[model samples]
Target: MKKKIILIAVFVIAVAASVYLYAMYKPHRDITAETADFTVSVKQLQEEYAKNDTMFNKKYMDKTIEVKGVVSTIDDAENGIVIDEKLSVTFNDSTKKEIAVGKSIKIKGRLLTYDDILEEFKMDQASVIK
Candidate 1:
């Protein structure tokens, strides 16, 4: 009985370790290759969130999305751009170029959160589509 219990415990331990290692070593998500769950203009996103914060949060939070708007600010430090003064987008790759203020553009990313204090939406792992 003792030997049987010891064998079972060893098997369990090895299985758990294997599972953990597999999870830890999993490949990172390729956000650029993912299809956007929802595509909307910045104004539309802001209005939906403003109308019902909890509802919009449940709908959008952490989901991949594409947004369209005119660029209002570009922060090289953050490696992102503010769209229409409401949505802040952070690019995963820094080599993107041709961005300019007042230019309309489209970006695909995951909707991270909405900052109530800043009255802006936050997204990351973005890439400019246009």
Candidate 2:
């Protein structure tokens, strides 16, 4: 009877530990080497998301994407650069580039979200196309 009880306690502890680990686990996504779910111009992306946000989110959320646009602003801002004043592509510190305003460029990034008030799309973990 004592052995049975001890076995049950151990089983319970094991299950609880497994549950905790599963809860804490967050797998990272590698954008490189993966085909982009969508390749779009910054202006088109902004317009699509603005017109039908729910559909846009369903298609682009948490996915790697490539965007082509002319840089409208670049500075020390943490919010990334504006694309024709319609979108912002914030770069990760490690992947940041020395890009100038008015330069045509393509960038790869994870589509984070859209801001309605600003009428802008935001990307995170962005890297400039070489």
The prediction achieving the highest TM-score against the true structure is 1
Lowest-sum lDDT 10-residue window in model 1: 91-100
**lDDT tens per residue, model 1, 1-130:** 9999999999999999999999999998888999999999988998898899899989999899999899999999989999999999999978347799998898899999989899999999999895
Model 2 lDDT per residue over 1-104, tens place: 99999999999999999999987896666666567888998767767777988998999878899988888887565747877777677776644356778988
Off by over 4 Å in 2: 1-10, 22-27, 77-79, 94-97
Which portions of model 1 show Cα errors greater than 4 Å? none
Model 1, residue 66: distance off in Å is 1.0
Question: Could you tally the backbone clashes for each prediction?
Answer: 0, 0
TM-score of candidate 2 relative to the true fold: 0.78
Provide the TM-score for each candidate, comma-separated: 0.88, 0.78
Instruction: Itemize residue pairs with steric clashes in candidate 1.
Output: none
Best by lDDT: 1
Any idea how many clashes model 2 has? 0
